[model samples]
Target chain A: MIEARGLTKRYGGKVAVDNLSFTVRPGVVTGFLGPNGAGKSTTMRMILGLDRPTRGTVLVDGRRYRDLASPARHVGALLESRAIHTGRSAQDHLLALAHTHGIPRRRVDEVIDLVGLRDVARKRAGGFSLGMGQRLGIASAMLGDPGTLVLDEPVNGLDPEGVRWIRDLLRGLAAEGRTILLSSHLMSEMAMTATNLIVVGRGRLIQETSVEEFVRGASGNRVHVRSPQAGELAELAAREGATVTYSAALAGASSAAAASTFEGAPGSEADAIEVAGLPSERIGELARAYGIALYELTPRLASLEEAFMDITRDAVEFNTAAPATSEGTR
Target chain B: MNETHDRQSRDRAPAASALPTPAAAASSRQPGTATLERGASARSRRGSAAARAGDAPSGAIAGDVTQARVMRSEWTKLRSLRSTQWTMGLAVLLLIGLALPLCVSASENWTVADVQAGSQDPVYQSLAGLLLAQVAVGVLGVLTMTGEYATGMIRATLGLVPRRLPVLWAKAAVLAGVTFVAMLVASLVSFLIGQAILGSHDVGVSLSSDGAARAILGAAFYLTAIALLGLTLGALIRHTAGAVTALLGAVLGLPLIFSMFGERLESAQRYLPALLGNAISSTSPARLTDLVSPGRAFVMLCLYIAVLGAASAYVLTRRDV
Candidate 1:
């Protein structure tokens, strides 16, 4: 269990991590979501006791990380970047860390194999690819086999296979009752992997809730009503609390302008009218009462990407939208 | 955070740490209860126990990193890097490689008058290589401490051992050991090689020659002192180029500047770094002298090392890593 209360870090005149508090509980995979430079890395550094907090404190397993009898045994954190010496072979790096606590050499090989770097375990880490570096970092974190695991952007620069491997490994660890807290700005990835979400924007906690709840909450009230009675159905949907905006394709929507078809399935488009503070069930009830046998009754939800973008729209310190080019590797 | 989850985690780690079989050991003791009392870092009320509470989690049986472990880690870090070896090799090559030939070439043109009057000490004359080689040793010393900061490897070091003092001490101890051994071998070999070439003028190698052994041994000590100075500068500057440059300025630049000004001002020459370290062989008519004894020079050299060393440790321990 990792609990941080009012952890703050300031570098000279600029604040890196402002008063932030949250607990990563056991038996679940909690995703730490934020845009780039939103203080995710700084928070992780303080969590590992690498950087000192300007105020308050962080507790890992009910004690400061440095105070732990064996910090590696209780918590295993993989920071956003790799920390192993490049000159050393991957195996040697893991072996040396294991040796510090007198952990057996067998565990080192286990982690190396677990991360699928068995082919290159004996090779120098300097020669490894960026994906391989992340793998080795993950391997090192697992070397101790602790109850709590912290991985920051573990999927960055990974191959699809490597990304899947990490997702599976983290899920397995969480299944085994480990407290798994992984950070990433990849909403699509976290949408599939995380059981719970902790969203931070501008170094402050924005929201902490279950994944399903977050999706549901971000979905809000936007829904679609497809009926032969387009005008009457639109009126019924509107009375049930949804705007009747016109679209150029699919089901026709009525407004001050002439009839135009709506595009796609009503649920996925970003421009779809948001029906806030209403349930999907209410839309269904209104559609049935209007004798409009719903051809499509879908609630438009902000996608994980959209919800994340919405939350970080103002908080992003660096780039906001994904760069025009493809995301490198994973 | 990962360190917390690591096998040596702060909470359950001590019991698991240093134990070959954590499972068997933890079975004998009641879990969480003992860890709660001694494992957690709690704020206790009042004096003694509070003081003990400040150190409550410190005395655990496991994760006990001894001084030996620290020294060993430092040695491994120092030796494992290619830069350390490269620096040592440069020192040997500069001192032994260039200086031996230079001394031999100088001897070819030597006159009896030149030998007797140009310089009082011929052996010390041949040992000028030390002046150049000390820079390489200084680089090696800087690399020992400052390289960690450059590579972000210092974070790993501090992670393994949070208290900054032990980390600094370990680096010093390892550098001292390596520098001592390297200097011992380098100085002896350099002396032997120079003696071989200086035989043309009958100006070299009289082991029976008074001050010869001390000169050779003192040269080694001089190099070692230089290495310590390097380590001290590294701790202070925390940058390889910066530390090496500062040390080179003090040992080399200051010497030239002092010698130049001393050509005019009276006693400034005696205070030059080259003069101070070279004072061991500075005796003119006598094999050793009372006015500027080797012992007193050794003492001064030692004082230079001590002041830098104490200041290094003081700054390192008092500040965060």
Candidate 2:
């Protein structure tokens, strides 16, 4: 398990990681989700004791990382895929780390084959492609067969197959009762692999929840009804306690006159409407009762990416268009 | 039907069922139940077996990151790099190559009365390569630390041993040991070859002669000290070009810069690395009255390393990787 309490880091006047606390438990892949510059890497660095925390403590297996008799045996971290000497071969690099804790040479070879890097193990790491470099890094992290794994952007340079490979690897490690904390900006990836998620935005804790709870908690579970009688159905759904909004494309799809021709029409073009707090079945039944020819009635569960955006909307550090209050200096 | 079943299982299993078995976990296939369980069980088996075999300190792969292990790691690191071989090879070559030709020419000139007019101190004449080889040794030392920072390997390194100081100590110990052994052999070989070439000339000095052994050994000592100084500098200035520039400038530049102060500061220049290098490599005492004793020069080199070493250790622990 990895526990960070009140961890804070500041670079000059800029805060990289603010007061934050979280526990990464074993038997699950805990996804550390954040947008770019969200301080995910900084927090991981503090956990590994690579960066001194300005004001708090982080412990791996209930002791500070430095205090562990053999840190690699308890905590294996891949902070950066290319955090290796390019001049050395993959085998030598793993061996060097293994020698630090007296980990046997066979373990190094084992990890090399485990990561499917046996073929290129003897070549200089400088020549490896990004995918190969990431493989070598994963190999190093697994060299000690540690009880915990912390990987940052593990799939950044991986192919589709490699991405699937890492998801499986992390899950397998977690199943062996190891705490797995993997960080990524890709929410969909995290949704697939992470059992629990600790999400941050602009260096502050936004939420910590299971992937299922996170998706379920997003506000807009809505049904989209596309029909020539959308105007009448939107009114009928609104009267039944569903929130209705005109789909912008509706006006362009059919005709402007067909929409604005009716005063107080819910839909602009009278072709489509979005109804929230109502199931597609109910919307379809309502259209049937009104004898409205419905072409499409589909429930749209918010994508994980959309849910992430909604959760981090206030906390996003980089927004293309400035919202309000002029907080860009951050 | 198969795709539907796969998607149904994936959607129904929740987080716990996502774990694959060992056979499917061999990094060959897409995520499957067999792969997750196989990978998990295989690791557990290996983990417990290895732990029971005493390869690790605990039932898990646990052992203290001791100083000895770190030193061995540094040895592996020092040897694995191609630059290590190139720089060390150049140092050895420069030491012996320059000594052979220069000593032979010096011996040939001793026969001519006009040639005898040249400075004929055999020890200093024979070890001319010591001057150039110090550069090579210093570069090796500088690169040893800076290379990690350059490639970002330092993050991985310190992540494994977060106590931090052990790394510096190990690196210094390994580099110093290697430099001492390699440079000492070079110095001794050069001296023997120089003496062989000199062959009974007035300037010829045997290993038994006064200060002859001290001079040869001190050359190695001086080179090792320079290497430590380079390491200390490399730690302080983590960039390769910058650290090497700073090392070369400090070692080679300070003497000339100090000498510009002229006679009043002449005595002070003896304490500088280059001057100390010269004194340690000489067979005779300092010709200048103000120059320090050879024994004192050796101590001065150690003092430089000590001060830099302390500063390096301090910066290393306090700074972010």
Q: Identify the leading candidate in terms of DockQ.
A: 2
lDDT of each: 0.67, 0.79
lDDT of 1 by residue, A202-314 (tens): 66788888776677676333565455444555556567666675442442334433243232232322222333446668766766776655556577776778777766676
DockQ of candidates 1 onward, in order? 0.13, 0.33
lDDT string, candidate 2, B127-235, tens digits: 8798899999999999999999999899989988999999999999999999999999999999988888887554567889778888888899999998898999999
Task: Give the range where candidate 1 chain B is weakest over 10 consecutive residues by summed lDDT.
Answer: B38-47
User: How do the residues A1-330 of candidate 2 rate in per-residue lDDT, one tens digit apiece?
Assistant: 788898888887667888889998766789898877778999999999889999889988778987877788777888754788999999999999989999888778777877788899899999998998998898788766677789999998989888877887787667656679999887779877887889887677888887767776776678888886677887889899999876666545444554463334444333667899887888888888989888788778787788888888776635434534223344
Off by over 4 Å in 2: A224-233, A236-273, A277-299, A317-330, B1-23, B26-58, B108-119, B200-202, B286-290
Best by TM-score: 2
Model 2, residue B61: distance off in Å is 2.9
Off by over 4 Å in 1: A104-107, A118-122, A219-221, A225-277, A281-300, A317-330, B1-62, B106-119, B260-274, B280-293, B296-321
Residue B118's C-alpha lDDT in candidate 2?
33
- Alpha carbon lDDT at A7, candidate 1: 84
Q: What tens-digit string does per-residue lDDT give for candidate 1 at B138-230?
A: 888887777667755666556655555677777778887887777767766776777677766765555556677787778878888888899
